[model samples]
Target: MTHVIDPAELKRWLSDGAEIAFLDVREHGQFGEGHPFLAIPAPYSRLEIDVPRLVPRRTTRIALIDGGDGVAARAAEALRDIGYTDVSVSRDGVQGWQAAGFTLFKGVNLPSKTFGELVEHALETPHLSASELSHRLDAGETIVILDGRPLQEFHKMSIPGAICCPNGELARRFWDLDISPETPVIINCAGRTRSIIGAQTLIDIGVPNPVYALENGTQGWYLQDLPLNHGQSQTYRQIDTPPAEAVLTRAEALANKSGVERVDSRTLDGWAHDADRTVFILDVRSPQETAADPVPGAIPAPGGQLIQATDQYVGTRGARLVIVDTDGVRAPVVASWLRRLGHEAYVAARTDLPAASHADETLPLLPEVQPADLFANGEPPRLIDLRSSASFRQGHIEGAEWSIRPRLRPEPNQTVVFIADDPAVAAIAARDISAERGAAFRLAGGPQDWEQAGLRVVATPDTPADDDRIDFLFFVHDRHDGNKAAARQYLEWETGLVAQLDADERKLFRLPGIA
Candidate 1:
């Protein structure tokens, strides 16, 4: 009974600055395969759990799409059931949007990536190609390579002699860089976007060094058959110097340009008491720093990733964002970027904020049935494997059917048992299933437990087509199968993003002087 919106009208609404949540209700993996550029991931399975956090306001315009999977209709119903006042589905889902001749973005965080592209186009960010940089390194040129990716990513693989100076810390730790102004500094990421943004960040902060992004980044290096150093762990630590006056002035100017607001502890406390508003207080610092001396209640989200994947962290578009940093430099810079994205962001530095327990504090332990017990029961429970589709196909219990967490539909008479890699996800799936069906249980340990218990598992020869919905698009290097083809495809996809931005006339991203 949900109303349907035509793709043309939706596009018009976007062009008109309509306040709406355009959500793709397919699984995250499926959504990642291809989707409308602005469509946020709101998989049909977790609609009830995710929508409230994402939209918050009951009257917000909500448009659901499923790429013709038929999940959109069900998701639309669920939204209405949860008291959402305005809800509708795309006329033909994602296909409808495409059939209407609108652009469909292939990756998550399109806004951030598009912004990076715009930055490169407008500012003409400097770059050093893989071959050129490799030759310079071989000749022992006076250069410093700073990897802008996270420490974990840096640990996996990096160009030789690259130091980890993750975004946000670049300005704060500039003096610690310990290089002459004439030294050529290079920055890189897994791909192009972060490399462009990171290099531009240093340039904007007025670093005297001649900065350049490693053209096309690590993928470019791999494509050129260049060697990469694995298991490298060079990282820059904070020097704890008082915030420099010049850096503070730069942050203030940027904040003023973006019209970012400022908040105190009292204002934050008042917002926390408002039931109608959703506020996210985040600590924009390095993982090592946050771990050593944690801030209570403030979620740990490094500034770069927060900007790169804002949808993942802050679901509600109109929600208030409070950024925290021990040094004044990082928070204001992050707030400035958030403001550019049309968020009501505030920068604050206060030690009196309330403390919150760890995010994983209160997980309920579900009743678990051992694999041996499950097989020997009078009536074996219906096995529901909650692993990724790709993982399930690799090896699963002989009769187990692959299932997603939020979309599990247990039969009233069936005794269901949930299995997943993580016990926490499995426990939640069990609880949700039990709410609908009379009884549900979880496997004691997970798939590993089944194998250790000498249970028979079979691998399917057929590669399941990722047609209906894919929840995850595992990085090529991260995939246990080591799909070099996936890596190539990802690089190709990323390479084309700049051109896509050029064609899309609706994007509103603006760099300081570029727009």
Candidate 2:
């Protein structure tokens, strides 16, 4: 029989030494708009296929939640249909969790804790925040406002004088940017993750000074209504419309006539090694995808956001660039987009990849899976989770140590398993991590796959333990911060959601002053 724990009790349990799998079966928009910090989102409709591909553990407990849309039970039933043994719905699903007094977060990721890690790391390396950045700009600090968005976006609207090229090429063609690392490199996106990842990438790859995210990029700029670049928002018009076939023919002719060399992936990777050369390697993938299997030295700027956010990326006014992607298609689009903006650009090709797949999409992979107990076996490879940061932090394999910051260039020193919400991204990340560091990597069976595979997941208590192990209950004082956040975050946990994880026998840790 499944256990039903109340919101207060559940948080305590999680903070203790338990390992629990969190789920929110709400619709995509609802899930995207707001959810708990740790709950990995699996839309009620796509659970069947996506679950198995994402979660690979067989021993994890399932925490099923919903918006009380009569789908919680159905989702749980589906979990059982898919062979999940330990499943329970939120007390009243989303309603109950919310009623319990937990705060919900808004973003594409749940357990929004990992973003903190990204920020911390970026800050660690000569980074600055939006507020701090404003001071520098006002004071005339020699700075580089790089729009990590694509060229079209840069042309459409961006901070005046910011260049394009998106996040993907920050390191791929760092030398191409031709600015001293000491020049403050500030990056921005429409919102958060991309900018966070982009800024972190520069710091991780040994950029001389600090890097920063504009916090909220163009939108923030607009929300503040501070000197808008309100030209027609034709961010992609130049790149998308193209310069006609004749223009492309002319460029091809120029390449042929000038005999300029076009290098492949392996050759480009070799060229990128020289510190003297500035190569900003751009990986064209979503921030979440980049998190799962990031190109160790590559910066991410998703294809869609590239255009509008370009001005925030290109660093200085006139920077050359080399763009990369999972395959060659995205690179040229971005490269050509940059060229249209009058920035020197090219797609460094790769032979190992087919013409269709031949760009700087190269990334590292994870090590093979030896179960979460790999540590108990005495040969613990560093346990790095590919799951979204919030998901990993709110709860994950007990005792598994993780570096919240996404690896810009992963080294191949240890065995690693890539656990994520998507198998494709996990597989790719694992493969890239492996390829780069030559480390052993494997895909964590995904959420549904874990239960279907009959793997065991420890139940996460809603509380913390003295030894830092996750238990079943973290007591909510009358006026504590945890009391508020947890209440709003797991509104449904108090009702049906709480019923799933609550256990009277699973007591919580009380404070010294508690009666």
Candidate 3:
């Protein structure tokens, strides 16, 4: 039986959580011209050698796709002979995805921003600017000119009525102001990403107020020839706390000593939105807390699991590492472990906290499925692994393409069944991300559940760059060797995958334009 999906509705399915597999049967050259994110390469010419290898699970919902109906039809029929129970041909193929106005992925990154129209995420907070405040203030509107510069700077000069709410204390002290959401809060700095981020911080953490940056910042106010007040700055020295700079500096100083790196939380929000983030993001909080809410692309691997899963976890070996957790307590421990392993670990610090101890960890890891399991079952029902990219590189199910974090791009209309080790975490991410264009699905028990159902797993060998005659896969299987021997094998294999892709001359003209 073949499964059909409307191209226009695919976005909805992805947003809603459907697990249908999309395969591009077109030739490498044809695919290179343009193709969808979820489309895996299984050239029709390799039907005899590759089809069975790539699609071991026959029961999956499959879309046999090509430049037109002809090759897709042939591939679909052959898949049936080989026991593929569900498959269908897209009436328009790659063209159809385009016709639907659905963004197509070109690089390893998915449909990118159109310069300005990139998605504005719900997880992030908003900021206000001086111009905005001036406009509102001039309009006789109730607005709070919350001066966010340091006490020294505030005493030097600031806008009229601008309260001495230092940028650093907004998280803790702003609460004392009783600023309502309706009252817009203006944030300012000497001029930098911090004050901008500070205003944004309150906005991100459920602060109901509309906030803005002082355009041009404190300088902007002066440039506009506005009045400046001095000696009215608020001081927190009597509170017996570390100065704001010292508090923010602790994260860096500790990181320097601990080797846990750092990333701008604001910019991270942008990367998280693009779906090109292939890093592993770990939150050391309890499972329940992580489930309640988390940074968009982060996974919960409490300190215990994080310690246990490090080597095989991909964050240590493959990609960059980021850490976030409850009040940043567990992150240092986790970061210490990864550092001992000689990995780069970073903390995605929470803007709301003065101490970085509550920061979370995020790193890219590969999927955890064996290659043999993938091809053993004849054809998978519907398959895709949703782990980090670093995880995908170590070892994965045979024929299971690296489609995990920052790499797994399912069409909106297709029902994509995701395989994650933790269904709860995946469910959370799926809930947040899948709601984007609409259409999404959860695999219930994830890869573990699939394995329990007698699915086989294999450690996939490196794929050649120009094996161009494949597409329309039914099932994607994976296997991971978290041990030393497996890791050694992976090091050798990654060297090869990189070399072949780099060496092959035909590679340029052969594969789709995706990275």
Candidate 4:
């Protein structure tokens, strides 16, 4: 039996300073449109896979919410099945929270986005409009543009000639760029948060160069009819030498100002042994560095992305975060931002920790059926394509019905065969459907296998329709797909987030001069 928690009580639980996993189990589209201020999205489609990482401690208090469609109940049952001892569902989910007179924030990464806006307002972070930068470039100005987004995002689209240097690496890699101290620097991201944060970081460090964030970032450039380069490989190179002592001192002072604590491996062990507290050990290094030599028992969370998307990495609000990095530079920089974001963040003094073991629960494998065997009898088994709706629309095995984990519906006692890109999704869905649906089998391979076997494949451009693509967030993504109105709306949304916060929500941020 599952317990029900009302909206007011759940809100109180969040602010009580205890570790709680407040998860919203709705799809991405629904989650992005509107959700509670601190709710982390753990969509029901991938509940088991995401919950373990988000809330590592199975015994932690977990509160699940949805759109009052009983999805929370289903998710609660799933978590309980996976060894989560303390689980409860929101009384009526988001609808209940609204009725109780709480704000439902629009957009994801609420805390981080709001903090970015507050930082700009408080610090008066200097910025340059896209037109201003463009004119300067045309005049042969010696300004250097640094794209503060990750390399992958930079590869997708960036200002022509911009070099990829993520915000987290800006402090450590700034000297390696070999630009003159007098040269002006401009930092940009897809939108505002990273650009502002990156620029403010340099200014705080007291660099000699003139630094300015590109206002509205790439979207601002697009609005000005500026060209963007795709597939660019320009990025900061790895340096053999360590950061300068002055740089390290400045970073450590900034971390101290934000109330960041430096802890050694023994201290981390003590925190891990505490049954009442939840501690997340995150390695705040570059992906390549972590892959080459990862710290034991640490999840790799690249610093810039982690600060930008804290809810994705750290699900348990108010929990202890131990950021690990080999260099003294990156961890402190990342921890300072995290502390201001209202998390109890600390940097690891050393990186020698014992490896933690994870539960290896296995899912029952459904029998596999070849394409020829799929239609051996007179009638074919009900073919359910569990691939993404977008992928299904691109092309799928002929006569296959598209469905997702949460929305699967099969006839009673029906023979079913699942075609999916990820076998795990199919296996989870197979375990979910009513047992009376008879035995379930997966296509030996996906649509590609069927195509290889000379089976018919079909495409339906308008099959799922825009509304049914709940897995994708069109509100945030449409701006990238050449939607001018969406781009403007998104910018407006980003600029207006700070004003939407309630008193309690606003109090979470501890910016300069704010008590």
Query: TM-scores across all candidates?
Result: 0.86, 0.41, 0.26, 0.96
Off by over 4 Å in 4: 357-364, 409-412, 436-438, 513-515
lDDT of 1 by residue, 1-515 (tens): 77888999887765555466788888877777688887888876556666665676677777888868667887777678668877888898888988998777877887777777767777799999999999998998999999988889888889889999887677677668788999999989987888987898788777899999998788788778788889999988658877778888887777777788777778877886775666778888888788998887777889888887777776655568889988888888888777766567888775746455235334555677888788786876788887777788888888888878556654666688877776556665664465653477777765577888888888874534555225666435342124556667777776677666433342466455533
Task: Quantify all predictions' global Cα lDDT against the true fold.
Answer: 0.76, 0.49, 0.48, 0.87
Where does candidate 1 have its weakest 10-residue lDDT segment?
A: 474-483
Q: How many residue pairs clash in each candidate?
A: 6, 151, 112, 0
- The global Cα lDDT (0 to 1) of model 3 is 0.48
The TM-score between candidate 3 and the true structure equals 0.26
Candidate 4 matches the true fold with a TM-score of 0.96
Question: Among all windows of ten consecutive residues in candidate 3, which has the lowest summed lDDT?
Answer: 110-119
Model 2 root mean square deviation, Cα atoms: 21.8
- For candidate 4, give the lDDT of residue 443: 89
Estimate, for each residue in 198-299, the C-alpha lDDT of model 2 and write its tens digit: 575555444576577676555455444445453433221112222344434443443333233355667665654443333445566556558887665555
Candidate ranking under lDDT, highest first, comes to 4, 1, 2, 3
Clashes of 4: 0
